[model samples]
Structure formats: C-alpha cells, structure tokens
Target chain A: GAGVSQSPRYKVAKRGQDVALRCDPISGHVSLFWYQQALGQGPEFLTYFQNEAQLDKSGLPSDRFFAERPEGSVSTLKIQRTQQEDSAVYLCASSLGDGSSTDTQYFGPGTRLTVL
Target chain B: DQQVKQNSPSLSVQEGRISILNCDYTNSMFDYFLWYKKYPAEGPTFLISISSIKDKNEDGRFTVFLNKSAKHLSLHIVPSQPGDSAVYFCAASRNQFYFGTGTSLTVIP
Candidate 1:
C-alpha cells in the first residue's frame, strides 16, 4: 500500500511570504498530523486532524500557521508571512485510527522549507 | 523542556554485535513509547513500541525494553547490520506524542 506522501519536496520562500504544503495520507487513514523539524532536531508537533475536524491546534506556533482538511482525505498546512525562523522541514503523518488506538503513525518524506 | 530524551548523540557498533540505544523521559504520564529509524532525506519509520504496562516487546531482530519506574527505555538490535546505520528517535505519548532529538547510529562492518 502507498504510504503517506507530501508534495513539493523543497520550497524556498522569502521572509514575509506565504507558502502552502500539501499532504496525502494513506487511503482509509482517519488521523493526520503535522510537525516541524529544525536541522539536527527532532520533529515538533504542529496540529492534528481527525477526519475533517481540526482537533488540536495548540502545537501550532502562532496564528500565522493554519491547516485544513475539509474533505477528510488530503490536508494542507499554510504558513502566512513566513519568517526566517520558520525555516525547517515540515513533516506529515497519518494513522489508522484517531489516536484512540495505539496504531503507529506513518510519516511522509516531508517538505523542506527555506525562508530567506 | 524535552519530555523524552536520547542523551547519546551517536553510537557506534561493530557489525554482528549487539547495539543498544537508550532513552529517558521526564513525564511519568507517558504510557506509550515508540522507536523510529530514519535515513537521510527520509521520514522516520516506526521500529518498535511498548506500552507502559509491558516491560518488553520484540520484533524480529529488534527488542524494546521499558522501565516504568525509571522512566527509561532501550532498544536492542542483535547482530547489528550495516543497514541499521541511521538516526533513531525515541518517542513517548500520553495524549500527545513527543520525540527525542534522536541518536545517529553507525554500524561498522
């Protein structure tokens, strides 16, 4: 089966610009999550979605970061007015269940965002 | 503050020998722990996991041991293979998951 995947493997944006990263979870996956990973650092949680509802947005750094999964299949993480500090690899993961089960999360290759 | 921690930044082990990776967490509420392996330009893949109620779990050549009282866990790979050389991350979750900085393991042939 195809695993989770992300588009635009690499993206370079100027400071104050906006960028949108996409994620395609495995078919039938009911849970999706986004994370940010700085060089040599572990990934940090961003937000989570179950089906079409955005459940947890507490991990989002600020208001500039937004995410949506309207149809319950694909998701997009949008960053408005990106900052140099936001430069990092954005990762997406999906699981079989909505955090209710101990199902392991399958991660995507990730999108490397470079903010100049 | 980091809830889960892989104190060792890197580890080196001779091929065919046993390699051990250790992790610790400060939050006692974490009931589930997982280990993931990652290669360059790739995402972290799930390796093995153990629930707090269980002290150990094994899969093929990999084994994960958890010590709930110490808030510590370790992954043991017997007969280490060169292909196992990569970054290994330890993660824990109560309601939300948290990952450690990760340890880069180099398996020498």
Candidate 2:
C-alpha cells in the first residue's frame, strides 16, 4: 500500500512570500498531522485533523500558519508571509484509526522549505 | 520545554553487536511509546511501539522496553546490521505526540 506522501520535496521562497505544502494520506486513513523539524532538532507538532475536521491547531506557531483537509483525503499546510524562522522540513503523517495514543503514525517523506 | 529527550546525540556499534538507545520523558501520563528511524532527507518511519500496560515489546531484531515508574524507555537492537545505521527518535503520546531529539546510530559492518 502507498504510504503518506508530500509534494514539492524541496522549496525555496523569499521572506514575506506565501507557500503551500501538500500531503496525501493513505487511502483509508482518518487522521492526519503536520510537524516542523528544525536542523538538528526533533519534529515539533504543528496541527492535527480528523477526517475533514480540524481537531487541534494549538501547535501552530503563529497566525501565519494555516491548514485544511476539506475532502478528508488530501491536506495542505499554508504559510502566509514566510519567515526565515520557518525554514525547516514540514512533515505529514497519517494513521488508520482516529488520532489516538494507540494509533501508530506513518510519516511522509516531508517537504523541505527554505525561506531566504 | 522538551517533554521527551534523548540524551545521546550519536552512538556507534559493531555489526552483530547490540545497540541500545535510551529516552526519557517528563510526562508520566504518556500511555503509549514509539520509536522511529530516519535516513538523511527522509521523514521518520515507525519502527516499534509499546503500550504502557506492557513493560516490553519485541519485534524480530528490535525490542522496546518501557519503565513507567522511571518515565524512561529504551530500544535495543540485536545483531545490528549496517542497514540499521540511521537516526532514531523516541516519541510518547497522551493525546498529542511529543518527540525526542533523535539519536544517530552507526552500525559498522
């Protein structure tokens, strides 16, 4: 089966520009999550979605960050007015069951974004 | 604050030897723990997981041991192969997931 996948493996944008990163979860996955990983650091939580409903957005760092999963399959993480601090690898993960502690997350290859 | 922490940044082990990676967490409420492995330029892949109820879980060459009292977990790999060389991340979840700084493992064949 195909695992979670993210598009635009690499992206370079100027500061104050807008960027969108896409993620395609597994066929039957009901839960999706986004994370940001800085250099030499572990991934930090960004946001979460269950089906088409956004469950948690508390992890989003700033108001410029936004995410949506309208059809319950594909998700997009959009950043308005990109900053150099946002230069990190954005990762997407999905699970077959609801976003619970027991469900193991399958991660995508991640999209590396660089803001200059 | 980092809820989950991997104190060691890197470790090297000889092939066919045992590789042990350790992790600690501040949250005792974490009910489930997982390990992930990653190569450069790739996202992490789930390796093994253990529930809070069980003290240990084993999968082939990989084994995860959890100590609830100590708020610690360890991953042990036996007969480590060169292919096992990668960064290992420890994650704990209550409702959301908290990941540890990864430990880079180098298996010399």
Candidate 3:
C-alpha cells in the first residue's frame, strides 16, 4: 500500500508570498498530522486532524498558518506572507487508529520550502 | 523551551557494533516515547516505541528503554549495519508529540 505522500518535493518562494503544501494520507487512515522540520533540527508539530475534523492546532506558529482536511483524506497547509523563518521541510504523517500517541505514525517524503 | 533534548549532535560506530542513542525530556507527563530514523531527502521512518508502563521493548535488533523516574529514554541497535546510518530522532508524547533535535549516526563499514 502507498504510504502518505506530499506534493511539490521542493518549492522556492519569495518572502511575503503565499504558499500551499498538500498531503495525501494513506488509504483509510483516520489520523493525519503535519509537521515542520527546520534545517538540522527535529520536526515540530504544526497541526493534527482526525478525519475531517481538526482536533489539535496549538502547534501552529502564527495566524498566517492555516490547515484543512475537508474530505478527511487530503490535507493542506497554507502559509500566508511567508518569511525567511518559514523556510523548512513540511512533513505529513498518518496513522491507522485514532489520533493517539500510542499509534505509530507513518511519514511522507516531505516538501521542502525555501523562502527567499 | 525544548522539552525533548538529544545532546549528542552526531556519533560514529563501526558496523556490527552496538549503537546507543539517548534522549531526555523535561516533561514528566510524556507517557509515550518513540524513535524514528531518517535518511537524506526523506521523511523520518518509525523505528520503535515504548510506553511508560514498560521499562523496555525490543523488536529484532532494536530495543527501546524508558526510565520514567529520570524522564529519559534510549534506543539501542545491536550489530549496527552500514544501512543503519542516519539521523535518529526521539519523540515524547502526552497529548501531542514533542521531538528532539536528533542525532546523526554514522556506521563505518
């Protein structure tokens, strides 16, 4: 079975531009998560979704960031007025069970966003 | 305020030797711990995990040990192979997950 997948393996954007990254979760996965990985650092949680409902979003850095999982399978993370600090790799993960810590998360290849 | 910390930025070990990676967390509420391995240009892959109730969990050549009192955890890989060289990340979770800075492991073949 195909694992979680993210679109645009690499994206270079100018500062102040808006960018949207997409994620496709595994088939039938009930839980989806988004993370941001800065250079040489671990991934930081961005937001989480259980089916079509967003359960947790406290990890989002600021108001410029917004995420949605409308159909419960596909998700999008949009960043408005990107800053140089926003340059990082955006990772997506999915799990079979509910959005619990006990469930193992399978990750995608990630989309690297570079803000100039 | 980094809750999870992996002090060692990098490590090198010979192939067929044991590799130990350590992690410490400040939050005691973290009950679930996980290890992830990542290769260049790829997302992290889940390795193993342990619950606070259990002190240790083993799968194949990989073992994860958790010390609830110290708020620390470690991942051990026996007979490390060249293919095992990558960045290892330790994560702690209560409701949401918090990850460490990650340690890069180099296996010399």
Candidate 4:
C-alpha cells in the first residue's frame, strides 16, 4: 500500500507570491495533519482534519494560511504572500482512523518550500 | 515557547553500543509520547510510543521509557547499527502532538 505523499518535492517561491502544497493521504486513512519544519528544528503542527471536516486549525500561523480537505482524501495547504520565514518543509501525515492516542501516524516525504 | 525539548543536537556512538536519546516536555497534560526516525530526503517514520499509564514499552531492539514525574522520556537502541543512524524526534501529545528539535545520531562502525 502506498504511504502518504506530498507533491512538488521542492518549491522556490518569491516573497509575496502565493503557493499551494498538496498532500495525498494513505488509502483508508481518515485523519490527516499538516506540520511545518524549519531547518534543524522539529516539525510544528499546522492543522488537522478528520475526513472532510477540519477539526483543529489553531496551529496555522496567520490568515494567509488556509487548508482544505474537501473530499476527505486529498488536502491542500495554501500560503499567501509568502515570507522568508515561511521557508521550511511542509509535512503531511495520516492515520488509520480519527487520530487518537492509540493510532500511529504515517508521514509523507514532505514538500520543501523556499521563499526568496 | 518550546514545549518539547531535545537538548542534544547530535550524538555519535560505536557500532554495537547502546544509544540513549532523551527528551523533556513542559506540558503536564501530555499523556502520549512517541519517537520518530528520519533520514535525509525522507519523512519521519514512527519508531515506538508509550502512554502515561505505562512506564515502558519495547519493540524488538527499541525501547521507550516515560517518566511522568519528571516530564521526561527516553529512547534506547541496543547494539546500534549503521542503519540506525538518523535524526530522532521526540513528540508529546495532549490534544495535539508537539515535537522536539530532534537529535541526529551517528553510528561509527
């Protein structure tokens, strides 16, 4: 079975430009999550989705960031007016069911976004 | 504020020796602790995990120990192999999971 996967292994964006990163969760996974990892740092949570409904988004940095999982399988994280600070690897993860303390999350390769 | 912290940025050990990675968290609400291993150009993979109720959990050569009193956890790898060299991340979860800065481990053969 294919694991979770993200598109555009690397993306270089100019400051103030908008960029969208996509993630494809594993088959039958019902819980999806997004995270940001800076150079030499750990991944920070961004948002979470259970099926088509977004359950938590408190991790999003600002209004410029938006995420959607409309069909409950594919998800997108869009950043508007990119800043140099936004440069990092965006990671996507999914679990077999609504992620609980018992479920383990499988991660994707991640899309590295570099804002110039 | 960083809730989870992995103080050691890097570590090196001789092959066949034990490697211990430590992590601490400030949030007392975190009940679940997880360890993830990552290699270059790849995403992190789940290694092992422990809940607050249990003090230890072991799988194969990997063992995770949790100390609720100290808000600390550690991952121990026995007879570390070259293939085990990679970045190890510690994560704590309450309602959501928080990750540490990560520790890079190198095994010298």
Candidate 5:
C-alpha cells in the first residue's frame, strides 16, 4: 500500500514569495492533517480535513497559511509572503477513519521549506 | 503554552535493558495517546497507542501506560534493542493533535 507522500522534499523561497506544498494521502484515507515542525521543537498542528471539508484549523500560525483538500485525497498548504519564521518541515498525515477510530496515522516524509 | 511535554531531552540505556520514556499533558480533554519514532531525514512512524479507557496496552516489547488522574503517560520498552535508538514523540488527541518535543533515546550495545 502506498503511504502518504509530500512533494518537493525541499523548497526554498524568498521572504516575500509564495510557496505551496503538496500532500498525497493514502488511497482511502478519510482524515488528513498538516503540521509544522520547527528545529529543536515539536510538531504543531496547522489544519485538518475530513474528506475535502476543512475542519479544525486553529493551529495555523497566521493568515498567511491556507490548506485545501479538494478531492479528499490530495491536499495543498499554501503560504503567502513567506517569512523567515516559516522555515521548517511541513508534515502531512492521513488516517483510515474520520478520527473516531483507533487507526494510526501514516505520516509523509515531509517537505522542508526554507524562507531566505 | 505546550500542552504536551517530554521533559527529558535525551536518554541513554544499555541494550537488553528496560527503557522508559515519559510524557505529561496539561489538557484533560485528550482521549487518545500515541507514540511515534523517527530517524533523521524521515517522518515519524507510529509505534503504539492507548485510549483513555485503558490503563495499559502492550504490543510485543512495546507497552504504553496512561494515567488519567495524573495527566501523565509513558512508554516502556523491555529488553530495548540497539535498533530502537531514535527520537520518540508523545502525542495526544481528541479532535486535533498535540505533540511533545520528543525524547532522543540511545541504546548502547
């Protein structure tokens, strides 16, 4: 079975540039999530999707962050006007259920985004 | 505020010995807990999990313990192996997930 996967293993952007990271969830995953991990720190929640519908996005750092899971299988996290603080690894995970089940989340390799 | 915390930044244990990693959380609403392991240049892989209803759950040599009243959680690996060396993360979730800073475990053979 294919695991969750993120594109462009690494990305470098100018401070004011916009960048988009992509995630491909498992074939039948119902729940998807995005998290940002800073160096020497834990991963912080960013947003969540329950089959194309954005659910909890309380963890997004600011208005510059946006996520969408249009087809419910693939998702994208877009950041506008990248900041130096946005330099970190963007992780995506997917689970078999809508989160009510004990199904463990499968994480993607992550895309390291660096803002210069 | 850090809702989930792993106070120990690192730990070293001899192979074939018991290794314990601890975690604490400030939130009581967390109903599910999970442990993840990661190597450099890779994403975290789920190791084990325990629900609020269960006090303990075991899988092979990996065991997870949960204490609701104490707001504490821990993972114990019996006869830890050298291959077990990696960063372990503690996570709690209900609707969203909160993760700990992670503990680096080194198993010396």
Candidate 6:
C-alpha cells in the first residue's frame, strides 16, 4: 500500500506571502496530523484531525497557521503570512484508527518551506 | 520550556557496537513513549513504542527501555549497521504528543 504523502516537496516563499501545504493520508486512515520540523530539530506538533473534525490544535504556533481536512482523507496546512522563522519542513502523518497516542503514526516525506 | 529533551546532539559507533540514545522528560503524565528514525529530506519513521506500564520493548535489533521513576527512556541498537545511521527522535504522550530535539547517530562499517 502507498504510504502517506505531501506535496510541494520544496517551496520558497517571500516574507508575508501566504502558502498552502497539502497532505495525502494513507487510504482508509482515520487520523491525520501536521508537524513542523526546524533545522537540526525534531518535528513539533501543529494540529490533529480525526476524520474531518479537528480534535486538537493546541500545538499550532500562531494564528497564521490554519489547517483543514474537509473530506477526512486529504488535509491542508496554510500559513497566512510567511516569515523567516516559518522556514522548516512540514510533515504529515496518518494512523489506522482513532487519533490516539497508542496508535502508530505513519509519516510522509514532508514539504520543506523556506520563507525568504 | 521543552517537556522532552534529547541532550545529545550526535553520536558515533562502530557497526558491531551498541548504540544508546537517551531521552528525558519533566512531565509525569506521559503514558506512552515512542522512538522515530528520520533521514535527510524525509519525515520520521516510527521505530518502536512502549507503554508506561511496561519497562522494556524490543523489536529485532532495537530495544526501548522506560524508567517512570526517573522520567527517562533510552533506545538501544545492538550490532548497529550502516543503514541504522539516522536521526532519532524521542516522543512522549498522554493525550497529546511532545518531541525532543533529536540525536543524530552514525554507524561506521
């Protein structure tokens, strides 16, 4: 089976520009998650979705970050105003069942966003 | 303040030696612990996980040990191979997830 996947493997955006990142979860996965990975650092959680409903978004860094999963399978992470600090790799993950800590998360290749 | 911390930035070991990566946490609420391996330009790949109830979990050459009292956990790889060289992340969870800075491991063949 195909694993989780993300689009725009690499992106360079001018400061203050808006950027939309896409994620394709594994077929039939019930849970989706977004994370940001800074250089030389591990990924930091951003938001989580169970189906089309976002269950937890406490990890979102700021108001500029918005995420959605209208169809439960595909998800998007949008940054309203890009900043040099927003430069990082955006990763997406999916799980088989409910969005629980016990469930194993499978990750995608990720989108490296560089805000200039 | 970061809840999870991997103090070591990098480590190197021979292919036949053991590689130990450590993680510490300040929160006692974390009930589940996980280890992930990542490569450059790629997302993290789940390696193994352990529940707070158990002290150890092993999968092939990889073993994870948890110490609730110390609020710490460690991952050990026996007879490390060149392919095993990658960045390892430590994650702890109760209802939400918290990740460490990650430790890069290099195995020389």
Model 2 over residues B6-55: C-alpha lDDT tens digits? 99999999999999999999998899999999999788999999999999
Give the CA lDDT, 0 to 100, for residue A43 in model 1.
92
For model 2, name the residue pairs that clash.
none
Clashing pairs in 3: none
> What is the fnat value (0 to 1) for candidate 3?
0.83
Clashing pairs in 1: none
Clash pairs of candidate 4? none
TM-score of 5: 0.97
Which lDDT tens digits does candidate 2 get at residues A1-116?
A: 68888999999999999999999999899999999999889999999999999999999999999999999999999999999999999999999999898888899999999999
Q: What lDDT score belongs to each candidate, Candidate 1 first?
A: 0.94, 0.96, 0.95, 0.96, 0.94, 0.94
Could you say which candidate leads in DockQ? 3
Q: State the lDDT of candidate 4 residue by residue for B1-109, as single tens digits.
A: 9999999999999999999999999998888999999999999999999988999999999999999899889999998999999999999988788999999999999
Worst 10 residues of 4 chain B by lDDT: B90-99
Docking class of 1: medium
Model 6: per-residue lDDT, tens digit, A1-116? 69999999999999999999999999999999999988877788899999999999998999999999999999999999899999999999999999788999999999999998
Give the local distance difference test score of model 3. 0.95
DockQ for the candidates, in order: 0.72, 0.87, 0.88, 0.85, 0.71, 0.84
| CA RMSD of each candidate after superposition | 0.8, 0.8, 0.8, 0.7, 1.1, 0.9
Error (Å) of candidate 4 at residue B40 is 0.7
> What interface Cα RMSD is found for model 3?
0.6
lDDT of 1 by residue, B11-42 (tens): 99999999999999999988899999999999
Across residues B1-109, which tens digit of lDDT does each residue of candidate 5 receive? 9999999999999999999999999999998999999999889999999999999999999999999999999999998999999999999987778899999999999
Screening candidate 6 with a backbone cut-off below 3 angstroms (N, C-alpha, C), the clashing residue pairs are: none
